[model samples]
Target: MSFTVYNFTNNDDVKILHQMGQFQVLQWDRDLSLAPWTAQQAWFASQMDVRRRQLIANLDGRTGVTLQAGAMQWTAGQIQATTGVKGAGDLLGKMVRGAVSQDSMIKPEYTGVGMLVCEPTWQHLLLVDVAQWGGSIVLNDGLFLACDSTLQHALERRSNLSSAVAGNEGLFNLRLNGQGTLVLESPCPQTEVLYIDLQNDEVKIDGNYALAWTAGLQFSVERSGKSLIGSAMGGEGLVNVYRGTGRIMMAPMQAATSYNTLASQPTS
Candidate 1:
């Protein structure tokens, strides 16, 4: 199908961040042109480094794309949407996973030759390659946006019970495996994200600042110090720990609050 998206790529306000395979991440550099009343607010937002971004999925007739439910903003050129459920058992599995992970219960799949655009958001958008993570990756809570349908999706359980309770994280995390591009709605921008590669080593984080990590890494929650008294004295109680050989995507700037919390607050 031959079609055109006028002003989408040529517009001065939009900036393309990353594009590969079936996904493209776009950012609105500035939104100060909206109106007189909001111009000052928009300028301040830009100065503070707040970004508004969106993800566009380009689909071919042979390959499909899966997106978080309610994420689709618009589509063009003969696209079809499906629940991506194979059977009753599949539906039950997704429902349980969604409840525990706090993800959308039903992710819709779009196929055919067309372009699917997701709703724009204030949070930063990141494009990840599954193959680069050794063919698999485990995601932190609520980072998933959209992914190529060729990847496999499953739940990865925390290494220990303490991780779920002490780390302030869920017992299960969403995992994607295979060779495909995964889109993430990150709490921080890619420039601020710290990537750590470990070889039979361990890394300890005082808070839930990790965005994603390699799938096989052992994750747990432990005291920050050798003893309880020492931990209290050190002013750190518990920390999220990752052990073994793998990689970690962390955002240290978000130690105090998440982007979602900041975005939800009323702005004068």
Candidate 2:
């Protein structure tokens, strides 16, 4: 019981930008009707000529792919999905973690020969190799998109209570461990991101600009300067501090500011 959607088609606009093992990253270059055809909509589109309207990921046969719940656009061939739960104990732990961290309780796992296409989004898609990330990576809330099935996820809590309260971030962050490729929804393109590698060193950020970091790094919220009074005099309050040896990905612009800019735009 099957049917064809299109009789003839040419994938001239869809170009594969990267391929890692069984994963292929395809970029869609087309004008999409993201909003109704109106003067303001046309103006916005003209002003913001976002060429990379969508990103499609192609999975090879016999491989497994896990994506953010509801991120899948369509699939084909012999593909089967599972709850990605090992047992009731794992289920309960994931449920508790999801409740606290604001992540999906159940992430669907797809296997077999098929093609999984994600919904078109303006957000930049980034493919991160976990091995290069020192085997473990801790992502701030809501950056997850998709990843290979080989990865394992857990929750990492802040070492100190003050870090959670003063840093303006959640106490628990989703930590992905193991060796595989991870897909992330970036607030900006990778070119706009700044990578800082530290060796037994430390860097303090004024705000929550750090997107992801190596799990080996110790993160805390502390005063900008050595002393509290000095911190105040330096015109800085609480700051996000990362110490030890690791790498950090920081965006020049704040994520909240990017979202606010998008929110002000007209949508259909």
Candidate 3:
């Protein structure tokens, strides 16, 4: 089995497939009188953004969701769409693994840009480079980082720069200042993740829903007391608080399992 990649510039001549088991690309790019690109070339070009705009599963209608690693070989029974935006990746019929996939290779430049977006209930492992981009995680209940060998060595030696920051929000966020990838599992995924940046300001959330934010941001948890009782019965729950200037990613209130169930069904 073999694969060939071709661009739609139409510069290459159209090659005919003579043999049976041979696979070749037939690129058609020039248009007799169209805008610029041929219809097929334009269509293919439009689909190029699929790489950049990668999103989580949409649990609404039919979808074409990309899966992380380990989850590559699941049946349709194991997956579903995860967005309100129709026609995004919704695991439908049979399941084929591909979302760049977990354990996929990483380039050095994506730092502070790569995001791991999964459904609330998904239990699959995600592969991310801890040194370069690190892992930007958010969970309502708990979060952990499984660093790669390179990162682990630095962590064990206490020689890591970001790890030596003492007991602060930076410690809680677990920055992989060294090199390696982290595999994280999150609990309570269906919650809203709001990344907020105040003007040297602050923000608060309930429970432990805060995920990773910028290192410059200060970290701590505080309580809202009954002395402010008027709103105590308002179901506001204790707000997991933060201050300073940076971003905060928060998860939603629903559990991952329930959200997954809802996602697998079709809309009425």
Give the alpha carbon lDDT tens digit for every residue of 7-44 in model 2: 11236656666666666666555445455645465555
Tell me the TM-score of model 3. 0.35
Question: Higher lDDT: candidate 2 or 3?
Answer: 2
Residue-level lDDT of model 3, residues 1-268, one tens digit each, is 2223233212352322111111111222222334554456445643531101112221222222233332222122223323212233323201211121122221111111112232322232233343333333222222332332233211111123242242122222233344444444433322334457666887766454554454455555443544446436656634445666666655455432233442343211
Q: Show how many residue pairs clash in every candidate, following the order shown.
A: 0, 0, 24
Model 1 scores what on Cα lDDT?
0.85
**Candidate 1 lDDT, tens digit per residue, 142-183?**
889889999888999888986468657788989999999998
Q: After superposition, how far is residue 137 of candidate 1 from its true place, in Å?
A: 0.3
* Per-model TM-score versus the true fold: 0.93, 0.85, 0.35
Clashes of 3: 24
RMSD of candidate 2 to true structure, Å: 3.2
Which residue pairs in candidate 1 have backbone atoms (N, alpha carbon, C) closer than 3 angstroms, thus clashing?
Answer: none
Residue 174's C-alpha lDDT in candidate 3? Answer: 34
**Can you give the lDDT of residue 99 in candidate 3?**
21
The candidate, 1 or 2, that scores higher on TM-score is 1
Off by over 4 Å in 1: 255-257, 265-268
